[model samples]
Target chain A: MIEILDTAPLSSVQDLGRAPYLRYGVSYSGVMDRLALRAGNAMLGNAEGLACIEIQAFPCRIRFRAARDFALTGADCAATLDGVPLPPWWAKPAREGAELTIGAPRRGSRAYLAVAGGIDVPSVLGSRSTQFRGSFGGHEGRWLKAGDVLPVGAAADAAVQAPGFGAEPPQTAFPADWAPPDLQPSTTAVRVLPAGEYGLFMEESQQRFWDTAWKITGQSNRAGFRLAGQPLEFAQRIEMRSHGIVPGVVQVPPSGEPIIQLSDAHTAGGYPKIGTVIEADLWRLAQAPLGSRLRFIPVTYRDALDALRQGDAWVAALRRLAEQYRSLCNSGRTP
Target chain B: MTAEEIAQIATWLRAAGLDTLELTSPQTRLRLKLGAVAPVKELAVQPAAAVPSSLDARATGLFLPIHPWCETPLVQPGQRMEAGEVAAFLRIGPLLQPVTAPSDGIVGRCLATPGKLVGFGTKLFEFSPEGKAP
Candidate 1:
């Protein structure tokens, strides 16, 4: 078991998501950065969908009740294990009562902590993800608070064999040219495919949507990110019924500012969608700090699918590498 | 200067992808680079027989002084290291192998270039016994 010593609001348990329940008005409430969680799990030889602590706030502290192996990924938060500094994207064994402190991140916003085995929370509706609106999944389906003791699943025998190891971060492994170029310092460019309602937008609005860099407003969370940019106007107003929406839908309400639905966004909405950020690029957007500017670069469906494959390949490679390293450490020791 | 320190400087220079390094001070002028056959003043090359104890790479792979996501080097000069502790990593394609310390000692100098491919048994670091000067 691991106990939360200190944590911020919105930090909670998340998996790949409660993906199957979207039809029942349930948001796909899960980690904002899927790659970070997957990378951390891979380091510990855990399953891809195992629950991990998604730390959205800074200066969080966790104490292990027993000896355990854990991996810290995603943000470069200057994490220290029992007063000894640990490298980012690193996994190591911790003795019982060891405290892991995570400071404010210098790069991304959210960090993921994955332990050997995984965070053992009772799965609700086929997933351990926290659905805050329904408040049914995860640890009582609410944000993780101080003094909460979280159970850990049994670790696989191969886990932690090569503890002091790390994998390359995706951004570094993939390189800048692998994704759309950032137009300015601290401004990210994400790939977007025009949505069904793209034609309804005025020609000038469409141009502005592609050209202008939108700043993420403070009113952002797991639900969605409200952006500040040139108002995008529709060619004509038409009444329409609420339709099902998924994460990454860039919806434009009457106010004209685009809002990208995210991990915990409502499953259905009536706002006109100008475009959808590709599934593979959502993690990058999720990691974008508040007030950072974002630009949309249009891509084709084929390109979007390719990017998804690239991400999956990266995770698979890390898992395979970890397993191989464990074998080397076990057999290659020279007395 | 110690032979290990000179070797370490060579590794650092090569790791930075440079071909030459020259240092100038009031007391001495030193120039070191790949394929240099001459010894310089104040930086005499020690006899090969006087080489210090070292950590050698167990597997042939690309050497990494620091993990890709980390800001600090895995092992720094003068840091105390325990036997079997990971001092660096060797990456072979997607696989990574830990390069561990052979004995409890003070880290002396890095003998391998970071990001460069190294062969098995290549000297990776200079490690001096606890009571001895590195």
Candidate 2:
């Protein structure tokens, strides 16, 4: 068990996300950066889709009720356990009564904290992901707050008796050498595919959209990212009935400002979609810090598929390495 | 015992992957411990007093006194630190791993050159117990 001493707003439990409910008007609310969630769980030898705490704002503090192993991934939040500093994207064992504090991130926006057995929240609608809009999933259907206690699931036998017991040293670090090249934060160019209404925009507007760097406005949230740039004008003013939509659809409203749908976006919309961000590049946008500039790069359908394949290959390699390391740790032979 | 005997024992302890070793005889008793990787040839006969110990690098990375941008080092030569207190940091890219003191002691010397890449098991600092030599 873990007790939340303090937390930022919107911090909640999330897994891979709920699916097959878009027809029922429910958005797939999971982690903002799915790769981070998977990486954290992989470090702990937990299932890739296991639920973990998604922390957004910083200075979040939690106290362990029992000895457990945990891993922090995604953003560098300057995490410290019982006053001892921890490296980002690393996993370590925490002793009972140890206080872990996460400070403001140095890079990226959100971080995921994954325990050995995952957070024990009752699954709702096929996922433990929190749908903040509907308030129906995750811990009490809301964000974690002070005094909230989260139960941990049963850990693997090897995880319970690993070497170092509950001790954490800086040497016991996992190298993320297998992360995909595209997953690195050095690039801000996101790949997009032309949607049905791509040709409806004026020639100048289309040119500006490709050439200009768009800044993510402060009004963005889990629902969608509101981009700040030149208002895009349409070649013709056209109206259409409400239609089904999914995350990654770049919808241009009457204000001419484009809004890219995200994990918790509405299931249906009526605005014109100029383009759709490729599924493989959504994680990049998810990790993009607030106010960061982003450029849209058009890619062919085959290119998007190739990017996804690369991501899967990286995850597979990571899984193999993590399993090998876990077994070595269990046998007291980890270097 | 001679310095050659002590050096041989230190080499043996390191080769065996053991941290400490102690042997007692009717005439003289000896204890040998391994710390940082320095010139073992220097481990010669000396006055029987508290010897300086060192904390070695746990991982290979760029050594930082505190953080990459922080001007202040985490510990000074004469500064005293409790067991488990962070004495330095090893930065690998953006990640910073804490280098902790092995025991309660007063820092004697910093062997590691700051802002340089250090290898695993490289001695970073030397310290003596509080009651020992400063």
Top-lDDT candidate index: 1
What lDDT score is found at residue A10 in candidate 1?
66
lDDT (C-alpha, whole model) for all candidates: 0.82, 0.74
Q: Write the per-residue lDDT of candidate 1 for residues B1-134, one digit (tens) a residue.
A: 34544554465456446667665433335577787665665555444443238887655578988887666888888889987678888775444567777667888789988999876558888888666777
**Share of native interface contacts recovered by each model:** 0.29, 0.00
For candidate 2, write residues A1-335 as lDDT tens digits: 98899997768999988768888988889998887787677656788889999998888999999999888877767888898776566677889998999989876688788888999899999899888888878898999999999999987644622212111111122222223244324436788899989899999998888777788889998889999888999999989888988888999998988999998998899999999988777877887777887778888999888877866655555554455445534554222
List runs of model 1 lying over 4 Å from the truth: A161-163, A178-182, A332-335, B1-52, B70-72, B82-86, B92-98
Which candidate should be chosen as best, given DockQ against the real structure? 1
Q: What are the per-candidate TM-scores when only chain A is compared?
A: 0.97, 0.90
Residue range with the least summed lDDT across 10 consecutive positions in model 2 chain B: B37-46
lDDT of model 1, residue A214: 95
